[model samples]
Target: MHSILPLLGATSLAGASVLQQALINPTNQVLFGSYDSKPLVSSEALEAQITEKNLRKRAEDLFSIAQEGVEEYNHPTRLTLCHTGHLATINYIYATIAELDDYYEISNQTFDAVVGNVFEYRLVLGDRQPDSVLAMSLTPPTPDKEAVFGPLVLVANDGCNESDFPATIKGAIALIKRGVCGFGDKSALAGKAGAIAAVVYNNENGSVSGTLGTPSKYHVASFGISNEDAQPLIKKLEAGDVIPSSAYMDAIVQKTGTTNIMAQTKGGDQENCVMLGGHSDSVAEGPGINDDGTGSLTLLEVATHLADYKVNNCVRFAWWAGEEEGLLGSDYYVSQLSKEENLKIRLFMDYDMMASPNYAYQVYNATDAANPVGSEELRNLYTNYYEAHGQNWTYIPFDGRSDYDAFIKNGIPGGGIATGAEGVKSENEVAMFGGKAGEWYDHCYHQLCDDLDNLAYDAWVMNTKLVAHSVATYAVSFKGFPKRTDVKMNDVSEPSIYHGPKLIM
Candidate 1:
């Protein structure tokens, strides 16, 4: 029988650890069994029970259930936000967590929203599979048809014209595209061109449901399209089916969303606290399963395990909202914290997208800087844990993207690990990690498919490993904040709360 071999080998020979005792006496297997009551702790089951691999499987399963119960689709035909779909996604997440046997316990549900920057328009090209976003951003100068009849032709719209189109007439409405400036530019140009109406296409991937720039003076009606739908129209104009009269083009830039959920452990090291956080919110439009229902669920699962752990330092768990809103929630919380309060804080640990579908694990502490006197030490701790586990790794920078940004900004040692997201998974990555090459690190990163049906079991195994490695490493290493001036960086001074005490029951 195997338990977590005595994590501590103290000076006294008589001070045999409970874990060591259990490991030495095979008969203890009967007392400390698994969730299923199996006497023999199979190496595979150990991987699933107390290891990172097991945690990730549980996390992904919850994500799958949330995905199925939510509406992740983005439709150009229908544009909305903070609506039924958004609430549905929240409901799904709550329901999934509620159903998990006991690994997750409901803590609290606080809801709020950020000022979303962009509008998401989904245009389904069932038969008209437009190659680019420009192709599908079709528009007419007016709402009415030609005197007798006419096929829809894209109207040109120069900024000078009220409409960006050549002319806003009876049959033809103004056909405007998002370009050269604000949505107002296309609309203003279309209005000057005499367009009765218009449609624009966004050059980006996510959403732009909200207005860009500001209040508009333009009179013509308009909407934006994604790049996937806009490219075909470019071809049509080149082929003479439509004319690119008054054209506009530029990448659509706007706000997405994020959520930050935080709560202190009922018990633990309070004076020297270790903070665990990950963004629960994604690209507003996505289920954000890997981007990161995985991280969020991992923390929630760990939270359930906390009530069983008693120790020295206070542990605080927070799920950040508005991470997509440029780390807003965390920033606000940190900003509002009394300076003295900030200093009581110990290390900050973040787990973001740890289970990449492609699963190429490249982690970072503090990105290079001449002053490199920051989160680098914290980074070493996490990576060191992996090394102790006989794992190899790479490190990247702590690019203030997630909720930890607020902590780092206030001079806190912020460290985090990520599997991969949105970035391309290289051919070399496939060679090393063995997932499909050339695919985005998270195929479902901000897509509606970031649900249970899309995750790989092995990927789940990998995600949980990193998360558990980070959490467990931080847990036993709870000597309080490392001596701020102590040069023994990455050195484990004391055991974390998880190693404190255990109830055989």
Candidate 2:
């Protein structure tokens, strides 16, 4: 009996004997002896060979949170209205939210409450200040626009380069803009520039987020403006328009109102762990049973089922709170992993809206897509399962927009499942699946009606099975499955060569 060191805590004793029996019975001398020499490996060693040691125990804990609806990854909460971001239900991308109130022209009294900014109230060109305040005439239009006002003021230092300020003071505001770096960097720089209330704007325009997506890291109220709006302000600068034009950026916007329910599974070495996650929250208008509930619940059920499976690897089953808000929960988690924790991640498997009338097993960065870091082995395991079960799948590249974004950027392999959402069904898909053409795979995508009624139970079950197999397969599979880093479709899980019904893209 050859001895093998155990890594993932599980051994081949469970079902390994069956494969061994089939191999050594010697009943079919010709077929059984493919191995010329005697097989010296023990069944326990075989089992141990399949177990993965990189998983965390929080899988069960996080899953329970989702099952109880306590950890809504996409909904607003006390922490973020919906853990979408540290901002409010809505926030400025690279800037801060704008606010104002309307008043009766004759009464000269504040009438309407505040709305959004140019970052939030960009839509409102008309003044909404209190009629009383507007009618007062600002004491003959105050000779200096730079006069420090007690109520709403856009304050800043004379220079734009220095970021040296002390926190000893409070109340005064700070003025900032894009350029010297990112939105978050601007906030820190401005804070150092000495101003409690911080207001920032874009340095240039076009699509401010660079083709990749928005950058992570935020500290204070940030605002984003279009080139049209920003350029005009800059033009004013060229013409010495340094006087405060408006006070929209002067208001306060808070995402601290949102809540992020984080459930984790402790492991031997949680410093770095694999994250299997899905969004647990829903859109404000919908219950969201399929757009993501399918994925969330699938992961939840798998975690629950595997609760007692003493995995050697730290396996963390997570439910994000701000997915609908553009992967906020996941992004937060990734950002917070310690440098050591970041390195421990084996891979990140994400399940978002994984069930639909028709399911196609897709991989991130498959055909011509791009992602930060992906696993070929895991990708192969998924595609291989479909092929093994007599299913065909397509490999495609996907923007790392899901919770797995931070992980991938930090060099963690990322992949996920998505039956379909927010897109029209292609003719091939419609013809293959027999669903109505010109319709979205998920008719209830983000609507209030996206409850269990809109779900296809069969599809949900299939996705669950796939996820189950994926998690189980990883927990106990030989070769430790495969990783899907590059778009090597044929490298690990090559399209099945078996003759079977063709699967349409």
Candidate 3:
């Protein structure tokens, strides 16, 4: 095992910085300066110390964080970091000796919240005997309790202009094809006309589903249908068939509170911070133990352990909220940063769902052409580590599927690790990882069953050690990463836009 005792007395630290000097000097030592001359200094030793028992204890500590909310709210709701949810997680983080604790918000956000939609629709074709048909899909925030019944009018692609909705659209249900602009814009334009509800069929095949970007003044009850299902109606409308349909929406739109817990080290180079995070909130379905609790606690445990170790670069740890609601907290955090602060973040690492019971070691495909510079190196870090341990690994795209979405949107180099979420295991994955094939990575994903028992301790310990490895490596040096001086200043001027495929739990 690698030992750290000899490094403490090395004379090479004579000219080092404050933290380096403290770490290297034997006389001016703090907690870890000299621990019985047999400290667990090496990465392997540290990893060894993070036993399953320790993880259970730390997880229990995290449960206490949620327990506080349960006591007050009479039920644990670590659902989102918004409102009281944010306060509880923040309190827990502050209980640690973090240097920075703050909530971040996007400048000039119009709605306090564009709450997620909860609506249902029933389709009825217009004829002497109209038949009841079901919509293949429905978008949220549909007009709750209100129903819109009328003949369907087709609006072609890029349904943003009023002209797209023909004069017949007045008091009718607008049938718009999805393309060009967002689903919200099409619905808004239809609402601008006299259309009571808007239904956007998919531009391609299969079921249609997407957010309206956000709530709008002109937004009406909106839902989606498959191209195949909508073609008959489109053809009938083309043949002048007055197909009448009824659309209704029931949704709750209100401002809910949440917070992002950002903790920066006070003793490191503030100009070149190494940032890492995982979403702090859970889905409303369950406690979200493996979904993100494992990911969040990985960083939290690492942060607590590093309290005594000095670092060259400021390491910022964030426990984001509203991730399940969309990448809300991370997007807001990126939005509020100044240009200088944005540039200071040399790299961002995201961790979510680190312990899927039926797991596959998947690293983000940072080597993809779309990723910012230095991403490939991040990929290599994890790949090399796993390979060194004789473990097989796979790659997932660096798409905007997680909290890393916001960072990458602004051209910040980002990478992360995940044990799968709803994805089913393949035979190859089964052979490599020894998990059952054709089963979800996490059987209880986003379900009420995602409790403490859902975790796979073996996977959790291994993945969390990887988190520690990355933190320790970057804390000591940015060897495999681009330095602050070499960073390309990408314009992150675009205001925060949280739009994309839903990040399934």
Which regions of candidate 2 fall more than 4 Å away from where they truly are?
Answer: 1-253, 257-273, 357-361, 366-374, 477-505
After superposing candidate 3 on the true structure, give the runs of residues whose Cα lies further than 4 Å from its correct spot: 1-42, 58-76, 81-86, 97-114, 117-144, 158-160, 204-206, 227-240, 485-505
Better of 1 and 2 by lDDT: 1
All candidates' lDDT scores?
Answer: 0.47, 0.41, 0.66
lDDT of 1 by residue, 303-396 (tens): 4444333434456676665555445556656666665566656667777776676676676646324112446666766667566766556655
Determine which window of 10 residues in candidate 1 has minimal summed lDDT: 496-505
* Estimated TM-score for each candidate: 0.57, 0.49, 0.78
TM-score of predicted structure 2: 0.49
lDDT of 2 by residue, 1-505 (tens): 0121121211111112111222112132322222223233222322222211111112222222222222443432212233322221112100100110100001001111111111121111112222111100001111122223211223233224443333422333344443434344444454454433333443444323211013222233333334444444445444644333232232222343232333333322343344587765555445565656666656644543343233344555666655654565666666666655555666678888765654444555532123333365567667776677665566554455467655656666677767776556767766545567788777777665565456566555555666766655444423443433332232222221111000000
Root-mean-square deviation of Cα positions for candidate 3 versus the true structure, in angstroms: 9.7
Better of 1 and 3 by TM-score: 3
For candidate 3, which ten residues in a row score worst on lDDT? Answer: 1-10
Of the candidates numbered 2 and 3, which has the greater TM-score value? 3
What local lDDT does model 1 show for residue 67?
40
Candidate rank order under TM-score: 3, 1, 2
